[model samples]
Target: MKSIDTEKINVGVVGLGLMGTSLIVSLLIAGHKVKAIAPIPEDMEDAPQRIREHLMICEDAGTLDRPVDCYLSQLVISEDYLLLAPCDLVLECVIEIPEIKRSVYKKVEAIISTDAILASNTSAIPISELQKGLFAPQRFLGIHWAEPSYFTRFMEITCGAQTDAVLAEWVYELAHQWGKEPTLLRKDIRGFVTNRLMYAVYREGLSIVAKGDATFEDVDKAFRYDVGSWITLMGIFRRLDYLGLKDAFETYNRLAPHFCNDEQIPPLMQNMVEKNAKGTRNCLGLYSYTPDEAKRWDEAFAAFNVDIYRLAAMYPSQREKKKTRV
Candidate 1:
């Protein structure tokens, strides 16, 4: 119920996969004492090495102030849930399965202090659904982080119906301290805001490809050269307001497809998943590309973020106005 002093807070990340590791390094970079946990003993053993690699990347990107080892020393990796007892905030980033998440939360509840806030990094599951059956559900919420979390400034903070307002505000303030532009969702909503808008674009993009209306390259190029650059700075809604809301609404009504229903997953996407073309992980998707190509795409995305941040910094009034409107 009280605001957390992030500098003094003990943070625990309860998964050692990509997301969990990213959170660990980002929290450490922000000067928080981090306790990182993994389910497997091997994962615990690899944590230090992974942390070092992440720090090296940060150094290469010119984002680190101290030596990697000095930062690594602040992170404590373990396989036992009991090690998280002292943490004031525990972020769960396990597999997306509801049962797995619930099991992790139950374990965390048994170990962490009574007032410790519980958060999930789930992108789709509702926070309320995840908090179901918990004795102190008000402390449970979602702190969804975008992929490559350490590099992305986008963060969505959602609170369940039972979540305390004071705690939500505390988390919002804490996220700002951690160098994230965190947006608080006043109520639990499916996909929150970012994903709701993003997935709408994604679903339509896939539909376009499925209907043979555009090639993958064409769609990528359209976003990259067109709306992508603008959205990076002013987001969709702000850009709409900037361009005149009436004009934006007219365009949306004119171009929005009426038949892009969610009744079925596109055959192309289904086939890709069925064929084990799991995207960057497997180096396959709507279009085939090498691992290096994927890396290039990632670097481009990071560069875009940095450029937008710099531009936004120059226009502080616009950024402040957007915050005020929110």
Candidate 2:
């Protein structure tokens, strides 16, 4: 296999929405040339400014080593798919509808080289399902990322039924260049690793609230104060080991029967959706927020991300520590 030169990589991002624009900054910070294609007119108009603002925040947080312009100069934001002809990798971050995503894939495949890898930023869709009808299905995979992509280290690289394993491993190496702790899933599954674990927690949390065992605020505090405290330093498996797994093993056996096994969506979430509550975007979430309060919360979350990024950096992964020793 040919080695990828990280410095010279030209990445194209389709769909210049929130995650798409944020992802460009990440690629730019890692010293890659980026071509951003906004499929919609609104995204084309808003993406540049949003990207600039995100970079400024990164600069303020000392994450961006050079001036924002230095990074901005590496970016080319447009509505033209032809501009993606030179991109070594292209990420599709459009809406989650299968039809919409497949349409974007058709246009992208027409432009990029056969060797160029095509990936999706899908959080819920199965990678194999999306790989269907693609001209080069072997080169297609899922490259899921968390929000505020530049600040977060989480990335999931998943392989579909037809995805080439060697190519998937290449993306694993590439993700490391982007400063991500990427997990490569050899087999495709809905929600992959992170979402599967998170959704389980959500199901249990919602079940408790619906059963009147605890209020949503109560559940939030437990998660924020308990799980939030040590999760950054150690994931769940490590936490179990740290606490002595014997007790955990016993507790799990005892509580297994009581766990929520509901297959249906929780009523709490259904009701919220019915009411058109879009959280901070509309200031109508589980907890009441005035317009001012909602804006403040949004600002606070962004600032908190920066702080958490710095904090997480202080504790490098075991893999990094092993490298340091070597």
Candidate 3:
């Protein structure tokens, strides 16, 4: 992949909610000029303030180099779509509704330059489905960023059937330039890579709890203590290869029955959704917690991610490369 000329590139992020705010922070820290756009009038007022907050959090955690104010100066927030014309890359992070996404994309397509790459942050929508009504489908793709996009380096770059390969490759390279560890999806698949693997585990986990095989805490403990640490460094495939592929596959085939089958949605999850019990936001879901408790959980999640990134940075090859680059 060819390197993006960081000095010449301007990134525009649409949607100033949690994910969009995080992306702006990441781009600012990577030394890129960023323009953030939000539909709500209040977001135009709060974008820079929120960006400053994120920078302060990073600085407090010792992950950033300078003051929050310094980074805030690099971000520009606008309510008009025309302000995005100068952006070389525009990432759409609106809510997951199809009509809402399409409406936003239409506005973005009108304002952005013909050469600008348009990407969606949708987790569940297929890239092809999103590209269907677009005039220039080749310039559009999916950039699946995990939650809290600032600190987490994993980025999945997926392309629709109509997406240009060269453009996809350019986006992949640009992600690295912005300090992301990006993986390219050669073909668009439902749920993408990370979600597919995670949902498989989640299905079984929910099933286990539903069947009274184990409590939620017990199931979480099995993964948190055993698989979590190892999987951080080595992925599932690599870990299996290290353990001898033949033996691993044989064991999986035999023990697979003990795991949950491809069954209907667990009753508990359906009930929660029906009641509008959306985890911490609604203060009730699989677990119940107060607003303060939810805030603590968010902090713990951020800190855990920070530690994971630090460990990833410590890879032997990465260490040597850092020295050589210096």
| Candidate 2: pairs in clash | none
lDDT of 2 by residue, 213-262 (tens): 99989998988999999999998999998999999999999999999999
lDDT per residue for candidate 3 within 1-326, as digits (tens), equals 43477757888999998888988888888777888888878888777677788888788878787788777777778898988989988999988999999998999999898888899998899999999989799989999887676778789999998999899989877787666778889789999998988888888888889889898889878888989878767778778877888998899899877987766877878898899998877678687789999889878887888888788776643324554997
Compare candidates 1 and 3 on lDDT and give the better one. 3
- lDDT winner between candidates 1 and 2: 2
lDDT of 1 by residue, 53-98 (tens): 8778778877788998888888888888999999999999988999
What TM value does model 3 have?
0.91
Best by TM-score: 2
TM-score attained by model 1: 0.89
Candidate 3 whole-model C-alpha lDDT, 0 to 1: 0.84
List where candidate 2 sits over 4 angstroms from the true fold.
321-326
lDDT of each: 0.83, 0.91, 0.84
Alpha carbon lDDT at 56, candidate 3 = 83
Model 2 local distance difference test score: 0.91
Kindly provide the TM-score of model 2 when superposed on the true structure, using C-alpha atoms.
0.95
Candidates 2 and 3 compared: the better one by lDDT is 2
Instruction: TM-score winner between 1 and 3, please give it.
Output: 3
